[model samples]
Each structure stands twice: as structure tokens, then as C-alpha cells.
Target: MKSIFRLLFFVIGLSLVNAQEIATTDATTPDGVGFKSKNEFYIFGDAVVIGNNILSKDDKKAFNVLQVNNDDTKMRYVDIDRDPTTFSSSQAALKLPSDFKKIVYAGLYWSATYAYEKGSRKQQKGNYVYKGSGARSKIVNQIKFSLPNQEYQDITGEVIYDGLGSPTHLINSPYVCYADVTKLLKEAEVKSGAYTVANIKATQGYLSGGSAGGWMMYVVYQSPTDNPKYISTYHGFALVNKEEPLDITFENFKSVEKGDVKTSVVVSVLEGDSDLRGDEFAIIKQRDGSFQSLSNGARFQQNFFNSSITNNSIKNRDRLPNSENTFGFDIAKLDIPNYNNTIINNSTSETTLRLKTEADRFYLYFTAFQTEIEQTYFDDIIQDNNPNASVTAYVSPEIVRAQPESDPSYNTKEKRKAYKYTKRSLNSKAFKYLKNKKSAAIAGIEGGYYVISGVFSESLRADKWTTKLIENGLDANAFINPKNNWNYIYLLRSDTAEEAFELTEELKTNYRYRDTWVLKANLD
Candidate 1:
């Protein structure tokens, strides 16, 4: 079986192109095909049977043809093997397409059929054989045919008929499948039209079983009109769990973390122009509980998929005397991965490959910074009220950690070197969502705080102090950059110089850690 694994793999790959039509035997079809009800009027296709074969006495590999719906109200059967009538299309009681230039695989499942008896005197009677219309043809109806092979040629092509015995014409015998019908159907051109930036357009409707995911966003428009359906539009580019289009904004922006849910987490970026058939890629679920393509917008750019976040909590230390509090961010960070370069034709526009953000630098009109004061300090008041109360506190903090910065200086010629070091330090495996949204200049980055520790008598306390600072409300994740020996801890959600100073003052007043300093905002 392992030797034939490649063959099986190819078959499975071909199956995906037609996911909607092919149902597993365990499942009932949407049209109620598996029901026992009589009025359902089941339809079936023709079968492929081997008749007069020289190799085997009884060919077991034969199949039937597809039967028509509402065409004939009768049923019949024909032995694929040794049945001269089966191979003769001239007197084929039923008619196939005249220009029937091709037959890929016979659609066995969708075809209709009836039953017949075997090895009885009545079987030899005309009632045993299936007749298309009239006569004593016993109508043991047969439907559906399995594909023969991968070869493809016009049904009108010439072939040498076997001359071992009497002359015979293998007319409709699928014994030779010279036409690659699978490829034709998959790459079939169903629709062709374009629209403006936000215009809604509809091509042909897609397969309903969530199989035709690539076409879902375009097909499932609310009104199906040319109007820009903002809210009703099913955008497949945001978090995958909830179906909603993220209004493009650029205020209060931080950084996009990888694995922050939109669809399947991007596992790996494959080499070369995007291969639509790549096994690594999956579906991008849309707002309407549907899915669409998440292929990257530009070439040589990273494509992103849905990402996951393990720990949303990042912290910084308290600098005030007799205090050990931690701070965190209001917004949670999810994970996302970089995409491999996608492929598109000359007519298609490039894709935008940045993460969603809300800031002035990343998004011109929008701001990503979100801020609010801690009106009721729960930890502060909780301990004062109930000295020994075993209570769980909501670990909400003021500063959320963004993807760590390597070098705040973005202009130096050495910046490229800095990025190389930075990419490696972040482990280059975690998710970042803000990266993609920043490219369009419509997202924002929020403000957060990091922690710095003062000199302590014990080495463990120095580390422990920083951890405790994060526990209260700080983005004090240790960003040990190799170049600067200075331990720069950042904080989230500070808007101005005064606000940063106030935070620093509070830190100094609360925890007695040594020299705490603030880094100036680099946003221009």
C-alpha cells in the first residue's frame, strides 16, 4: 500500500477540486439522496462495463453509465463484459452526447439505477436486460461510471481495434481514457468580471458545503448588488473565530503579533510563487461563517494565516519604595505567521501583506493608542479591606507589551543589521498581527509600559522584582538587545511626556528599585 501512496495522494488531491459534488458514503447528500422516500425522483448517470475482454472470463472491474433525470421513466441494466450491445453506440438504446468528445471519470455516485436478477431462466429472458425505451429489455437500471485512467484524447480520436477475433468497435468503452477531464473541470472558467475597490460583484454561485472556500467572500455578498456593503460584507481577512469585517483604522496602534486568529495559523512559507495546490495552505473563514482566500497581497512578501496566542500577559517592575506591583495591557496579543510569496497574473493587483494596526505612523487617519485610568485599584484596596481574603483578581494591566523592538532607531544604515539580530531574538516563530495592517497606513499602535529594575541585595530579587512589576500593570518583558547593555523595559498606553513622567514617578514612589528611566517616544 505504501508503494501506491503516491497514486492515492494524487487521487485525494483531485478529489478536493470537487469537494462539493463528492460525498462520503457515510453522509447523506444535501438534496436528500440517501432517503428511502419514493417521490424523491432519484437521478443516476451511465456506467462503464468491460465486455468481450480477452484477459479475464468474468471482468469484475466494469461499471454502468449515467442515467438521466425526467428523461425516461424506466430502468434497465447491461453487463459491461461480453455484451455486444453495451459497446455499440449506433444502436445504443440510450443516446450519449453526439460530440461526446470526452469522458473523464463516470460520475458513479450521482447516477440513478434499478436492480436485476442473475443466473435464472428469466434472466436470459428480454426482461433481464435494460432497454432504453421499448421491447422486452429487462430494465435492471444501472447508473454512474468510475473513471478509467489519466490519459486524455478526443473521443473522436483513432485507435486500433483488437483483431484477434471478429472485428469489433469499442465505441463508448471507457477502456481508454485519453482525455484529462479532471484538469479541465478544475480550471474551468465560470466567471470573468472586475469591480472597484469596494464594489460587490457576483460570479456563478459556489459549492454550498464549504468546499468552494476561495469564492465564498465574493459570492456571499448581502445584496448581490454593486453597492459597497460595509458591515454586511464578509471579509475573510480578520480573526477567524468571529465573522466580522475589521473597519480599517490607524489609531492607538501597537504591533501585529503572529497567530492572532483569522484562519489556520500559517505553518510555513513555501518556496517559489504561491502554489494554490500547496498542501500547507488552508481556508480563511469569512464574516458570514464562510471562507475565502488569505493569499498575501504582494509578491516576495509574507502571507499570514490565523494565529494563536499563549500568554497575553507581559509585565514591567515597580520602582517605588516598599512596592512590588506589575502592570499589563488592556488589549490581548494573538499569534500570526509570515506568508510565503503568493502568485497572481499580470491582470491581478498585488496583495497587501501587512498586519492590522491603528496608529498615525502605520495608519494616517486612524490612531491605535487606547488609554484609560485605573479608577479602582482592586489589588490596592482588596488587600487593605480583607487582610487574608483568598480572592482571585482580574490581572488587567495598563501597559500591554507589543512585539519587542530591536532598535528604536529606524534610519541608520546599520538598521538592517539590527533587524537581522532582532528577527532572531524574537525566536522568529511567534505570531504578530500588526505587521500587515500597518502597510496600508490605516491601523494604529497603542501605548504600553515596560519595567526596569533597581539594584537589589540578591540577584534573584532583581529578577523577581521585575516579574512582580509586570504582575501589577506594566509591559516589562526583558528585551535583552545585544548591542545596548542597557536593560530597556517598555510600558504600554502612555500618551504624552507628562503621562510617561507620572508613570515613572509612581514607579519610583511604589517600588524602591534603583535608577528607573523613561525612553522618549520615537514617533514623528
Candidate 2:
């Protein structure tokens, strides 16, 4: 029976709440978490970095960093125009706050177009051109500081920059050059009153006579709090197939800032063969310090039902076997206050954690943040099998996303949606005339049990997933049962039990829903 359960688990993966106001594509999972499309890390709330909303094209969109390299000051609130030769006198800087706010990351957005002005070879009249080298290579730009008058350094390290294609080949290319200047900002003292921020002012020696070329620095700041929580996921768990342990490194993830306290650690294990005691995972402080067990109040793992696979177990038989195991627990046993907890330490928080596998292989996920600081997905926007969100230069608190229907086709998927939605001003006369313009189907949903993908406890999450399914042209619904405390996110419903069962089987085998099951309850 257990083997049957394992097989089912292997064939079908686990799931979670798909909240409304979401999108297609994977959210920016920190480099550590192996789990993609499941977890995320972002600021708790929204913030404005450099509200540059000054462009006729794509004007409504907010940009923390804007480069008026086209020599158009109308495109930015604080435009820094300069030629390469005037570096000494043509530098620009923004003063930031010295309070709890910290610059998490920074980037330079690249954008340039050819002007009617003559070039050396030809008089290109209004033709478009690209910035940076033609190839997908690194272009280093100078950024200086004003607080202590420090020296300039070339921004380098694990940065993700997008590539805009050649001038003629690409129509829409939103590319950014990423850089992290956290260490430099942390050590620099704010000038007498303001944050002596970055110097993102420079130019190409050849952008002469109105030929556009400029640079903008996108600054990301995190406002500190009395209690800051952090959540993170790790990748590369599949690389280890045997019963070997993997190190959970914190160096790459910016979870722990200065002056933090040790909090709880939740270790999630997916597709494993065995159960885990809360003690299997340990937090090792420093390189040689003692290992601390965080399993204070451990919740034993719960086994979910897999209908695709059946076994000889009397209660559940005749179906395909389900063999997958999923479990997670909080570190409740360790005396966090007694020792210097690396996860909660005020200085140099947890460097690494050790996770031992129960069997041959499994995927591990964890989020460790200090008090009040919790982990979350970026604005509830996630993607599965979709293009990734482009790397934007400026960092905001979180993203604002619309929910997806069951099919979850991208907004770009024109065929899936019935109509195209365009943003219009509230004051527009057409909006008033078309305010009541909404279309409805000729018929309503049929009655019967719903063959659902997953049941969620959160109504918001259930509704979110339902929207995605609906957008995909599926008859998805989020049925709530207050008495049973169930929120079923169903894909399709039928009038008869036999039909529902057949549909469930079809979904399991044909629709990639190996664990799809039927759900029925009283409407009243």
C-alpha cells in the first residue's frame, strides 16, 4: 500500500493556492531555492524608488530609474546629461534617507535610438539603434559615491542582464544591466542629512549632436522594521540522487540583514521516500560551532491521497500506486535564545544549513527570517512553463498582477481570451459610455461533482486559481464549504457520477493531472 502511494506521488506533484491577480511565468525565486513556481521572495509592501513617469510612450508605467540618454529632460524628473569628456563635472547623485532603509540592488537600463543627425558613415534619418556592444557581453559603467568620497569601482558579480536584439531584428526589447551595491551602501554613512547615493552620470564620446545616448541607475531600497521576516527557496536539490546531505547556504540570499534575531526555520521536503523527524535538519553556527536542533513543536508529516494509483490496502485499492512523500516541519526543539542563532544573529546571520536526505533523493525548500519578517511570492504573480519575467533595473516593493483562469494561458495568448483589455482613464468619455459593456454566456454551469486539481484552505488562493483556469477557457470554479472548511478549486463539473469519474480519469492521464479527483457537496 505504501509503495502504491509512493508511485502516485511520483507521477503527480503537489500543489498550493493560486491566488487571484496573478500571471504566467516563474516569479524571481532567489538563486538558492530549488523549488520553482512554488515559493518567492520580495519586500512585504510596495515602495517608490524614483518615480520616473515622464514618457509619452509607456507613460503610465512607473520606472524607478529612467535614462534620458536621448537628451530629452522631459523623460525624467532628475536628468543628468553629460559627455564622456566631462566626467569630472557632469556627475549626478541622489540623496537617500539614513533611516532603516537600505539599497538592496541596483541596475543600469540601456536604451538609445538613432537621430536624424548624420553619423560618420551615413546620415541615418530617424532609424533606430541599440546601446552597448552588439554581442551579448558585459558592458561596465562607472558609478561613484559622495558620502565618504570613495573611489569608483566596476560593478561586477552574479548579475542578470537581458539582451536587446539588433536594431532591425527587434521591435520591443526591455533589457537591463543589473548590479548589486549593498555592501558599499551599508558601510557608507548618509551625508549630514541625506543618503549620498549613486553617481549614474556618464556618456559615450561619440553620441554627438543630438544622437541619443545616456544611462540611468535603478536603486532598490528596503525599509527596515522592528520585526523583519524573510522567506527563501533553494535549487539544485535534484543533483543529489543518493542519501547525501546538501548545504543550505545563506550567503547568496539577502534574507538576513544587520541587527536581526534568530527566528524559526521550516524545511520542506518534496518527492522523498521516507519521513523526517524535525531533528534531521540542523543549523550550524559559524564554521565550527555546535549544531542546534530547531524541532521544538514538530508536526508529523501528513500523507495526501492519490487516486491515480491504487494498492492492495483494504481502504484504498484497485487504483494505480502512489509512492510520493511530502513533508515539512518547523525547528521547535532548539533553544534559540541560549545560543547565537545564525539565522537571527544581528551580525553575519546564518552562513549555511545542513539538510540530510532520508533516502535516495528529494527536493528541499526553506525560508528563515527574523521576527515579523515573513517570506512571500512576489505580488502573487507566478508562472509555470512560461517565459521568465524580464530583469528590470529598479526594484520596487512587490508587483501587481491580475489573476489567471484555469487554463492559465498568458495574457499574450490572444486566442485564449475572448477580448483584449486596454487601460483607459476614468475621466475619459468613452469609459462612461462603455462602463456597462460586459458579455455573458447563453447558459450556466451544469450541476454535479467537480473533478478538481487541488483543494485550498484559503478562499483568496482558490479564487485566484479559478481565474487562471477560466482565462484558459476552462469551466473552473472556486466552491467554498464553510461547514466542512473546504475550498475546492475545480476544473470541470458534470451532472452524473459516472461522467465525472470518466472525466477525472481523462484528466489524470491526458491533462497532466495524474492526481485529479472528484469532489461533491451540498449547495446549501
Best by lDDT: 2
Question: Quick one: best TM-score, which candidate?
Answer: 2
Could you give me the TM-score of model 2 versus the true structure? 0.25
On residues 241-331, what C-alpha lDDT tens digit does candidate 2 reach at each position? 2345455544312333444454443332322222322224556655357655333221221221110111112211111111111011011
Off by over 4 Å in 2: 1-48, 51-148, 157-175, 191-524
Predict model 2's lDDT versus the native: 0.31
Q: Judged by lDDT against the true structure, how good is candidate 1?
A: 0.19
Which 10 consecutive residues of model 1 have the lowest summed lDDT? 1-10
lDDT against the true structure, per candidate, is 0.19, 0.31
